[model samples]
Target: MTPILLIEQVLNGLQSGIMLFLMAAGLTLIFGVMGLINLAHGSLYMIGAFAAAAVAGWTGSFTLALAAALAAAALAGCIIEMVVIRRLYDRDHLDQVLATFALILIFSEGTRWLFGSFPLYLDVPAALSGPVRLPGGILYPSYRLLIIVIGLLIAIGLFQLIARTRIGIQIRAGESDREMIGALGVDISRLYTIVFALGAALAGLAGALVGAIQSVQVGMGEPVLILAFVVIVIGGIGSIKGALVGALLVGLTDTLGGVLLPLFFGLFMDPSSATTIGSALASMSIYILMALVLLFRPTGLYGRA
Candidate 1:
């Protein structure tokens, strides 16, 4: 591949990493603070996308769509928490898993019922629809660059929120000891709702942002949700730092492997055969990385020592 193509793929990988970070950050927080394994977290992402699409269709404005998406997702999360998820909190992981899985089904069918099976489309805003030239005369999509910027900003905002704020301290405390926090009059239940809502909002934002590039439809978040799981697994159960590193690792590994492995294999085999073999390996690259990380640091890179 040409240097320009390679550079483009690198940028693509970074964008993908940022997207994964958006989803995984919330997943890690939910797991860390609530100790709840929400399989339907991806559904929240879907909700965000659909909400954005509907609003954008109505208003013809991307910014308004995004705002509606965040609000809708946050509101949906709070409602779900109050009505269904709260009960699952005191239950076992198996119960939480089952309940959330049911949520996925409900969300998928509900979306289909509302929007039909046809996928909705989101256009890149006019301001970011073009490409910018790089130093090497390579052009890159402005939208992808925007994704990276937004992702980094969210990461910084998250770090500040969790590390420096009072709510962050309460969340960390809740993670460490729920009962003790309640005993100290922290209103652990309310805190749990807030944390869950935040996670859901992040997931929603990711979905809406990505919907502009991909088709928005039922079950759209499932694939990314699985990748986000891999991210959390590699990052650790409850560590934000781990999620960031692990997401970037997975994103870059997956992207580079898909591109470079074929080239590497082509050196020794026919192009077709090389592509076949390379594709399989590329798909497995993140899993291999996950395994290697686990073998060395079972808890993940930024997990507790």
Candidate 2:
């Protein structure tokens, strides 16, 4: 209702969208270039959170925790790519899906066993722990603001890497014609591994950054993973630009719908019924957006036909 509240919600949406973009960016890249449906991607997210929490606990420093998380997730991704995902490239999507699903089970249970089903807590670094006053005198969490800044920076960096760098050129080429790149001595196999690991690291970073605000627990990445899928689907597969737009759209839709839908319904319906029904519909809003996007552009807003 209030302008400040509305601004706060927008910030929330932006934060959520950025995180979704981080997850979706890698997902789209993997699907576009490698043609693998990695259901285990969420598992890498969880691994990163756990790794960060564990390292932070041991070292009492968020920086070390983040470093450990990124490295661990990236390393894990490389191993998975080399040992498990490599065989699936030549196989069907169903096979890749099933294998990755199994990987989720292994990762979840392994983490539970190691961490003993207890959730770990990550603290925002002391420097980033407070609130910053924004224009119009609204205060926002520094950590959340940091997330937005980091996400945008990463987005820019990714754009530059893909558009300006040699590796980006190779990645584009590989996406268009893997065989041609292989023939050109691009080391397609190694590239695939590096891409997977890079994606894993991004997801890991998302988990670590988000873990500071939420509990570091098992299966935390699943919901975000689903949302990330929706984001990429709406944005268009294999398009980073699409992923960024789609993620923001989803974030704003989900956040605003959750807050505003119930209010709108309460005007005409009983308050209790409006709250329940509105909540349900709000949760479904992004999927409906996805459906509409698919209706008009099945490949996504930025995805190539």
Total clashing pairs for each candidate:
0, 1
Computed on alpha carbons, the lDDT of every model, listed in order, comes to: 0.92, 0.93
lDDT of 2 by residue, 212-255 (tens): 89989999988889998899899988888999999999999999
lDDT of 1 by residue, 154-228 (tens): 999999999999999998898788889999999887898899999999999999999999989899989999999
Angstrom error of the Cα, residue 264, model 2: value is 1.3
Q: List candidate 1 segments past 4 Å from native.
A: none
TM-score of each: 0.98, 0.98
